[model samples]
Target: EPEVTQTPSHQVTQMGQEVILRCVPISNHLYFYWYRQILGQKVEFLVSFYNNEISEKSEIFDDQFSVERPDGSNFTLKIRSTKLEDSAMYFCASSYRMGGELFFGEGSRLTVL
Candidate 1:
């Protein structure tokens, strides 16, 4: 079965530094999303993208954060400035049907120092 893949499985960044996490979703999937989980906390939705535009975003997607699909296949999430609170396991998910099941990546762990 196809699955989402993320690069740089683990990343460490200094506070105030910028970081970008990359992912490639399953070829047949349409809906794409970014979600994060702080250690020992619930997974929180960050943003959803479809048809080359942002479909929905949560409060956590502040001005300092952005997402883009530079090429049709790869989706990237960039954080303008890293903060201690931003350290978490970020997951990339995709689904063939909107509002349907989402297949998630192993996770990209971010550590802000």
Candidate 2:
């Protein structure tokens, strides 16, 4: 079965640097999203994109973050400047139908010093 793939399962960086989390969502799926889980917090949605525009976004998605589909199969999340609190597991997900069950990649663990 086709599955989503995330790069660099673990990442470590200083308090104010850029980081790019990558993913390859299942083919044939359209909707894509990015979410994060603080060390002991619940997974929270950052943003959802479809047809090249943002469909939904949580309060957490601010100026420091951006998402892109640079190619047909790759989706990426870029953090312009990371902070200590930005240390978390970033997950990429995609679904064929809106509001349907979302399939998530294993996740990329980002640790900002």
Candidate 3:
């Protein structure tokens, strides 16, 4: 079965540095989302995208965060500037429709120092 895939399985960066996480959702899925878990915290929703436009975003998804579907097969999340508090396991997920079952990637771990 098809599943979400993320690149740079783990990344270590200095504070204030830029970081980009990439993902490829299930081929036929329609909705895409970026979610993060800060260590032991609950999974926090960052943003959702569909039809190449942002559908919704959380307050945690400040100006520093951005999501894009640069091509038909690729979805990405970029952090303009990394902060110590931004360290977490970023998960890329997708579903056939909003609020449907989500297929999640193994996750890209980001560590800000």
Give all TM-scores, in the order shown.
0.97, 0.96, 0.96
Q: On residues 50-100, what C-alpha lDDT tens digit does candidate 2 reach at each position?
A: 997788889899999999998888999999999999999999999998777
Candidate 3 on 1-113: residue-level lDDT in tens? 88899998999999999999999999999999999999989999999999999999999999999999998899999999999999999999999886799999999999999
- Pairs in steric clash, model 1: none
lDDT of 2 at 55: 88
Segments of candidate 1 deviating more than 4 angstroms: none
Q: Could you tell me which residue pairs clash in candidate 2?
A: none
Query: What shift in Å separates residue 34 of candidate 3 from its native position after superposition?
Result: 0.6
Task: Score residue 19 of candidate 2 by CA lDDT.
Answer: 98
* TM-score attained by model 2: 0.96
* lDDT value for model 1: 0.95
Prediction RMSDs, each to the true structure: 0.8, 0.8, 0.9
Positional deviation of 2 in candidate 3, in angstroms? Answer: 0.7
lDDT of 1 by residue, 15-87 (tens): 9999999999998888999999999999999999999889999999999899999988999999999999999
> Candidate 2 vs candidate 3: which has greater lDDT?
3
